[model samples]
Target: MNKKIINAMLVLGMTAGLAAGTCTSAFAEEAETEEARGYRFTWVNPIVGLEYWSIAEEGMAAADAKYGTDTQTVGPTEINVDEMVKQIDAAVAAQVDGIITMALDPTALGPAIQRAVDAGIPVVCIDTDAPDSARSYYAGTSNYDAGFQAGQTMAEMTDGKAKVGILMGGINASNMVSRVEGFKAALEEYQDMEIIVTEDTNADLLIGTQKAQAMMQTYPEMTAIFGTSSTDAQAAGKVAEEMGITDQYCIIGFDDMEDTLNYIREGVVDATTVQKPYEMGYLGVELLVQTIEGNGPEEQVIDTGVTMVTADNVDSYKE
Candidate 1:
C-alpha cells in the first residue's frame, strides 16, 4: 500500500494511547547521534536474549557494517505485549528514524506502529507478521507455508498415519496460529493423521517439557509431535529421552536454534523448519533504511524463506 493510504488509515482510527510509552534515554541518545553519524533504526523483539534474536542481531550488525546504519536491539525480558507496545512508543518519542519489529500482537502493537508511522518512522516486521499493523514491509518466513512443510515432512516420516500433538510457545502469536492452521490443512490429506492436542507453553521450555510429557501421558497413542515454537521440539525431545522412547515418535520442531540443530544432529528431532533470522535482520534494516530515505522498498513482503533441516544437512547449521 502507498504511504498516503496507510497514513489515511492511521488518521482514521488513531489509537488513544498515543503517548503512553516511556521513551528511555538510550533511544533518545541514538536519536541525538543520528545526524552526526548515520540513520538510526531500532530492532525490537517480543522476547530478548534468545539465540534466534542473537543470530538476527548478527545480521543487523552485518547490515550496520555495510550500510553504516546505527541500529539498536531492545525488547522486554519476557513475552509481554505491553512492553512491546511501549518500546514502539518509546522509539517514536525518541524520534528514531525507523523501526524493525515483529508484530507480537497486532491488536496492541498495531496502534503503536501506526503512531510511529504517523510520526514518520518507517516500520518493518520480521520473523513474524501482523498484517493488520502499519508495518511497511515484512522480512521473514511465510509462517503458514513453513507449518505446511512441517506437516508434510511429518506425514512422510510417519507414512501418512499418526496421532499428533502440537506444542506452541504462545497460543496467541499470529505466526504460531498460521503454522497451526497450515499444519492442520496439510494433515487433512492424511485421514489417519490427527492433531489430538494443542499445548501452550507460555514460551517456557520447562513448561513446554511438562506439557509435552503430560500430552504424551494423556495420549499414550500419540505417534507424532509438532512444535510450533523454537524450543518446543527440544522440550518434547527431552521428555521422549526421559521416557526412553527416542526415535519411537515423529517429532517436528521449529527454527534452527542451536539445541534444535543439535537435536537434529543427534537424531532426536526428526526434522525442523529453519527460518533465515540473519536475512530477516539484514533485509529488515535494508528495507527500513530504504523506506526512510524514500528510495522505495519496491516490495512490502520479503520472505527470507524457510528450510527443513534433518541429519542430512544438520552439519552445516550445527554452528
Candidate 2:
C-alpha cells in the first residue's frame, strides 16, 4: 500500500458521497411535488337542491378548478340532520385531507365534527356554524347582523310604526334563530311596531304561503311582514299579491333568490338582505386549504359581508 495509492482512494470516496447526496435531494423534491398535487377536500352541506346551496356549490367548483384540489360536495336532499351526520361520518372514514360543512344542528353534529378534528382532519364551517364543535374557523355572514340589517330596513319602510308578522325557515337552525333574535333586537327600539305573529314554514315555499296567509288572518291589520329566509320572504309577497293586498303590506326578507328579487322589483317586498353564499363557499375551501398547508387565517370567524337590496339595487341582482 503506497502513500499515492491511499490518496487516490480517499478522493474517490469523497466523489461517491457527493453523488449519493445529490440523488437523495432529488428524490426528496419529487416526493414534495407529488404531495402538493395529491391533497383532497370534501364539502358537506346540510341540504342540497336549494338555489342558495347551488350558488355555494358553484363557488366550491370555482375553487376546485383554480386550486387543483380534488373537492366534492355531499348533502341531504332535504333538511335531515341524521343524513348529514352520516355523510360526515363517511368522510371521516375515508380519511379526507380536510372537511367543510354547514352544521345544521350544532349540538347534534358536534360529536361527529369533533371526531374528524381529533383524527387530524381540519374542519371549517360555512353558512351555518357549529361553534361548540372543534372547528378551526368559520366562513360566512353573521346571521345576527344580517337580521339586524333586515330589521333596520323594515323600520324605515314602515316609518317605525306598524303591526308586523314574522316568517322563518327551519326554526331550529342556529342561523335562523340568530337572525330572528337580531331582528327582534332591532325592533326593540320601535315601540309602536308590534310583532303580532311569528311562524316557521319548514323551508317550504307552499307552506310559507299558507303560514303568511294565516298570519295575515291572525293579525288582520298587520301592516308589514318580515321573512327570515328567501322562501319565507317570497311567500309573504306572493300571498299579499294573491289576497290583493300587496299594496298594503310592507314585506322584507333575506337572500337574493330570483323570486325574492322579483318581489322587490314589483314593490311587493320593500327590501331584502342578501348574503354572500358564494364567498362562503369559495373562502371555505381557501381557508381549509390554508389550514392544511399550515398557512391559515388568525381569525376564528370570517365575515363575508351582507348587502341590503331594494328596488334601487334589485335590477342589478336580477339574473
Candidate 3:
C-alpha cells in the first residue's frame, strides 16, 4: 500500500473503534438510568397526628414500596388550611414527581393547587377535594353517602324522637356541610326528631369539647350528639364522659380514630361512620403513578365506601 493510504486507513479504523465504544457506554448508561431512578411522590394531609391520617399514610407507604418510589407524607399538626397550602407550595418547590393533598378548604387551596399543576406537577386530592382546583383526581369516600348513613344510624339509635346537637369543624368545609345536611334531611323525615343546637369549633378539640359541654347544659333533654369531624367526635365523647352523661346521651361520631373506637367500646359513643382513609391514600398514589405513565383511568372521582362501626362491630375494625 502507498504510505499516505496506509496512514489514512489506520486513522479511520481508530475513529470507528472509538465511536463504537462510546455507543456501547451510552447504551449501558441509558439502561442503568431506567433501573436506578424511580418516580418520587409526595402526600400532604390536613393533619398528620390523627390516627385516621396515619392509616392513609400507611396506604401511601405501601404504594411507595410497590412502585419503588420515594414517598413522603407532610401536613399540619392541626387542621390549618394556611399550613396545608404552605406544605403544598413546598412540595412544588421540591419538584416532586407528583403530589397528593387533602383539601380542607376547597377555596383557599385552589390557587396553590393550580400553581403546582401549572408547574407540571401532577396533583391529586385525597379525602377532601378542591373541585375548582387543577387537581387531576379525587380519591375519597362519598361524603354525602357517608353522611346520609350517619343520619339514618343516628335516627334509628335515637328512635327518631330524640333532640340532637351538632359539633362540626366548619360550615364552609364541603365534607362537614354534606354530613350536616344529610343528617338534617334524614332527621326531617321523622317529625319527632329535632336538631336544636349546631356549633362550629373551628377544628379545635378543646373548643369542640367546650361547645359540647355548653350544648349539653343548654339542651338538658338532648338525646344524641353528632360530630361531623374526627376531632369533634373526640370532643363530644370526652365531654359526655366528663359530664357523666354517657349513659343518658347517645354520641355518634365520624371517623374511626383510636379514641373514637375506645369510646364506642366503652359505650360512650353509640356509633361512628368509618371512612376508608387508608384506601383513599393508597388509591391516590396508585392513580398518580398511572396518570404519570399515561395509563390511569379518566374517572375524576373515586368513592371509597364507608362502614358504620358500633360496639357490636368494633371487634371487626381491630387492626
Please provide, for model 1 over 157-267, each residue's C-alpha lDDT reduced to its tens digit, 9 standing for 90 to 100: 999999999998889988888999989989999998988889998777889999999998999899899999888999998899888898678999888777777777787
lDDT of each: 0.78, 0.77, 0.76
lDDT of 2 by residue, 1-319 (tens): 1111112113212211001112111111222222334568888877677888777776665566556677788888777888888888899999999999998789988998999999899898987777778988787768888898888888988889988888988889888999988888999999987888889887779899999999887788899888887688889999889889998898888888888887888888888888767656766776788898787655667766577889987765422
Candidate 3 regions with alpha-carbon error over 4 angstroms: 1-37, 317-319
Q: List the residue pairs that clash in candidate 2.
A: none
lDDT of 3: 0.76
* TM-score list, all predictions: 0.87, 0.86, 0.84
TM-score result, candidate 2: 0.86
- Candidate order by lDDT, decreasing, is 1, 2, 3
How high is the lDDT of residue 217 in model 1?
Answer: 93
Candidate 3 on 12-110: residue-level lDDT in tens? Answer: 122110111121111112222223237888888787777677777766665666566677888877768899889889999999999999878889999
Better of 1 and 3 by lDDT: 1
Angstrom error of the Cα, residue 67, model 3: value is 0.5
State, as a TM-score between 0 and 1, how close model 3 is to the true structure: 0.84
> In model 2, which regions exceed 4 Å deviation?
1-36, 317-319
